[model samples]
Target: MNICWWITILLLLHSCTPGDGMDHGIVGGHVSVPHSRPYMVYIRDSIQPNLNCDGFLVREDFVMTAAHCKNLRNPKVYLGVSDTTFLPLGIEVDSFPHPDFNNEPGNDIMLLKLKTPATLNKTVTIIDLPNLWNDKISKNCLVMGWGSTKYEDYSPSKVLRESNVTLKDLTNCIEPDVICNEDPFGPSQGDSGGPLICGDIAQGIVSFRKTQSKGNVTGYTRISQNLLWINVVMKQHKP
Candidate 1:
């Protein structure tokens, strides 16, 4: 689709569902390649016991995720594991979305702070935020999460999965706040809040994806605009 079409579709909504048009999620067909991505996180909201979303570590104590996925009642952050049900180190803490966040007007990004800084090891690491502000970074990117492996199947994946997407130039986005990615297997339901990575730097947070078409129209919250906010929040909440 054209750049204008992508920007036009981003309207206000009840919540940021993270993918276009659906009940099930992340339509990609593959397993996560081993410990290839250890920064992936499983977020469980107390408000919705069954709803689990994904996020990533941008700092030792901060996890970046989609704002719409915000849940406040002793939320859980699970890291250092491939399987959600496995014995990975987990933490329960409060989550904070961007102060400018609203589901519809979409700033769909948030920072999660741990009560104690996560113990980083080989299995648990941090994905650096794109330290540069260049509008034209690499279009090639990788998004990993524990979302559905098929459409209309709300079943969260046993392990994390990575979907290949291209951060094409869609310069017309509103406020230039969101980035649209081209992917056949769009960021599914549970995939919300996951990071869109360019090499080791995190470029985007999986927002919403459009469905019922040839492919999903995936969108992410451009991290560049929120870099200052991220830094301020991290300082205020440093463990």
Candidate 2:
């Protein structure tokens, strides 16, 4: 069978399911070296601890994540953390989901403003955004998170995990603002809001996924598509 046929089958199965898509985790990925991904952020609601998502620091005071993660009551972020058990005290943050966000796919990006500027160090640094919007997608990309490593287990990983995914053609993507990738080893549940690093630049943010018995396809909100909005938000809300 052709690859396109398989992808179509996956999408059809996913569409048949009822309700909204579920958050994904780093399935079929391996544990990452401690603090290797300096830009990574682990987010959780202090009041409802179970609500969690991954994020990446883009500026001293701004962390980018998925808009759907804004449901947290008291959102806090753990920076420079590799293992959940050895985390430092989380910093408080105020969420700024995209103005057009409505818990949907296209506008699934958000920014978390740190109450205080983050101390940039070897173990906690910000990643750069794309310099220009490019229609051509890079072939290889990396995704890291503290989300679950398997589909059956819903518990998130204590140690961070990393996976490599190949960007699919834009024609296969569900929306113009999303970058799509389908691989045997890809994001599953609890991996929302993480960065999709392509050639050292954060090009996408983990948004949603479509799964089926055969496999799954993950979508990341294209950062380049919303670069103007991100810049404006960060500039206006500077601390």
Q: Which residues of candidate 2, in runs, are more than 4 Å off? A: 1-25
Tens-digit lDDT string for candidate 2 (1-239): 24453343211111111222223336776778888999999897887666778899999999999887877768899999888778788999988999997655678899999998899999999998986676455778898887765655454677888998887675567677887777787665667889998888899998777675756777789999998899899889977
Supply candidate 1's per-residue lDDT for 122: 84
Top TM-score model: 2
Q: Per model, how many backbone clashes are there?
A: 9, 5
lDDT of each: 0.70, 0.77
Q: State the lDDT of candidate 1 residue by residue for 1-239, as single tens digits.
A: 35555554432121334333232224564667667788887787655446566888878888888887764355678878676657454687667889887554357888888877888888889887876566556777787777765545455566777767776675645447788655676566677888888766788888876553555567788898787888888888866
Q: How many backbone clashes does candidate 2 have?
A: 5
Inter-residue clash pairs, candidate 1:
12-104, 13-104, 18-207, 18-208, 19-209, 20-209, 20-210, 26-188, 66-193
lDDT of 2 at 57: 94
Error of 2 at 131 (Å): 1.6
lDDT for model 1 comes to 0.70
